[model samples]
Target: MSRFTRTQKILMCLIGFFLALGLLFQGMRQASIGDIGYSVLSYLKYGLIDYPLTSIKNFASDFSNLWKVQEENDYLKEQLSMTENYQALYENAQREKRELQELLNMNESLSDFNIISATVIGRDVSYWNDQITLNVGSNDGIQEDMIVVNSQGVVGKVHKVQDSTCIVKLLTCEDKSNKVAVRINFQNEDTGEDAQSEETDSASRAESVEGILESYDADEGAYVVSLLDEQEVEEGMRVVTSGKGGVYPSGLFVGTVKKVESLENQLGQVIYVEPLSNFQYFDYVSVIEVN
Candidate 1:
């Protein structure tokens, strides 16, 4: 009871050591087996369980990344659309600015010719004689009989002038009262010189003189001559103001003749013409004032 014998103590010590060694060896063996099994699972289940799990995790991350990318793409597209709209507006403004500059240059070139610059403020489309109202008026030294010509050609005459505004009759009015003598510039194919209309010829009221009115410049002698003799004027013929009634200056540019048509008159021929200036598109003009 007080103390064990030396032999007994030695035996107990031996048993304890063996037991500890056995436990350590068993734990090592189990760990080795677990590591071997894990290695096998990685190799065998690569395409099935383990690999599929890894792929699913990667796919989830990719889906999140894709959502962010799509959002960014949509934002970029919206920005591009806005930029395009802005570009179109900028281009339109630039075109208008260029046109205004051209008009200013034309005014400078016509300094020798007395004229007034007028801005169109109103348009009358309903009346038989469509008229355009200008910002200028009698107060601005504008008066009736003043000829108005835009960048294209002759627009009309100042029919009425108020204190602050004036009315301009367009050139196309069909009142049978307004008439301007237009000379066609044709090269006599035989003479090689400019074709001349002899006013001395017998004045005969031919059949209806139907021709598209075109603009002519008196300076260059570009205008529509008569094609009534069934003789179509050659292309590149110039038309000019005849200075017959002094309606427009003799040398101002109207437009070039593109084609001609003819009708038989009882005494002479009637000619049809196509004007070169696109009158319908111009927005500004110059009013010719005779001193």
Candidate 2:
């Protein structure tokens, strides 16, 4: 045989090299496929060619899932917070509604009176007396000396008024003075020159028949009824507004009498009064607005 040419020899060597590499790669692929692996070995064979691309793809998918989960969590948390806030607001509104309804019921019970419901805005008992402030003012048609009443009884008169606030004097306050009539029904002793006990019924009747004089002194009685001279009031009787001055309306309930003093020249009487307004525990009140 003639000596092989240089080009031919080069071609032959290249073909042999390719043949060996093909066999080696095929054998390796068969061995990898035979091994038991879920996705690792298969990815290594196919994914190694563009390793960075495959890795980026996997990283992106994982990042997307994590982002979706975070967004869902944030939304759920926001919803829970809003739910709590709405529940609290609802409860507060219900409480306010109940209070308003009760106040309205009190307004309907008054006889012969026009009611103007107002809220208590400010209160100070410092200077004049136990005086409170109301939200009604001149613009709301509130005037001076208007009678204010609560569920229990009377509050006081309007002392001062601004555009949106008014000062109300309390009944038992130091500065405020009220005059009322009262009555007391108590059992004590009878006044007497002619007073007869139950035991001396027949004797007393026989004496009276003889004209021995049955003179009973009103002053000698243990309990007596008299006018409250200082307060211009009477004991053991209903104390109402005599309507002496134009200040208060007539027949408004002022208070009830507790006691009276007996005196000679004047109607001797002292009165213990229970104010109609329970100021100690009053929350709502009404002002009479006569049109």
Candidate 3:
């Protein structure tokens, strides 16, 4: 027989490859042939590559939102701080306005003297209640013995005067030289039944009585005024400067009678007068230079 050729051998191998391809397609047809390849490729892409990338993107977005929330909180805190500062400024302005109005009224009543307005610049820490320093001095016509006052009542007198500052010795000092001649005006209305035991049975109806404020009673927070003579005095009596020695002016309100005590060894009664001015609230004052 003729020897088998290379061309026939190649033909037989190709036919065998076709037969295997045909059998694989026949098996796929039974299980949705057209979609199986696509489904496998899609599952591998989404499950391994696409799903992981999507999770990473979502995590980054969540981080960004958290950072934004923190930024918003910081911004709110800054706004609140500014609001508090503005409120403090407004309150200070209102306080200054009220003080100015009160000073205006006081100016009208004390028109007789050369009024020099001043601000409290310094304090005597060693003797806080006894002394304070003012912003006015010799240049401002503030001299020694010049009366110092606020809207409420007498503050003190200029003790030492400098070129632009003066030290005021307060009337509330314990010194014996703090004496002021005072006149007491008894009230016509009843001052309730809780009056001190030293009050007389009869409502004191002397048009007015006179006393000398000699010292300060720290325990009672009152001024101790000694009567010139044994005179009937009661609670609710208005006390004012008598202008006798001319240190303090006439009709300057000093205080009101808080209590009265009769001295057994002395001939006069000790009157306790509550000061008209709040000693704790001193900011501005006026120096009275007798024109």
Candidate number with greatest TM-score: 3
* Ten-residue stretch with the least lDDT total in model 1: 201-210
lDDT of 2 by residue, 1-291 (tens): 759898999999999999999999999998887775756777777777678787899999999999999999999999999999999999877755765675676567655677878887766545333678888889888888788876645567787889987888766554323432223222224556544455365443321100000111223321122332233333434344444445655545555554545555854344444445344545567898644
Alpha-carbon lDDT of model 2: 0.59
Candidate 3 on 52-88: residue-level lDDT in tens?
9999999999999999999999999998998999899
lDDT comparison, 1 vs 2, better candidate: 1
Q: Rate the local accuracy (lDDT) of all candidates.
A: 0.65, 0.59, 0.83
Task: List candidate 1 segments past 4 Å from native.
Answer: 1-112, 123-129, 188-236
Q: Name the better of 1 and 2 by TM-score.
A: 1
Ranking by lDDT: 3, 1, 2
Better of 2 and 3 by lDDT: 3
lDDT of 1: 0.65
Q: Give the better candidate number (1 or 3) by TM-score.
A: 3
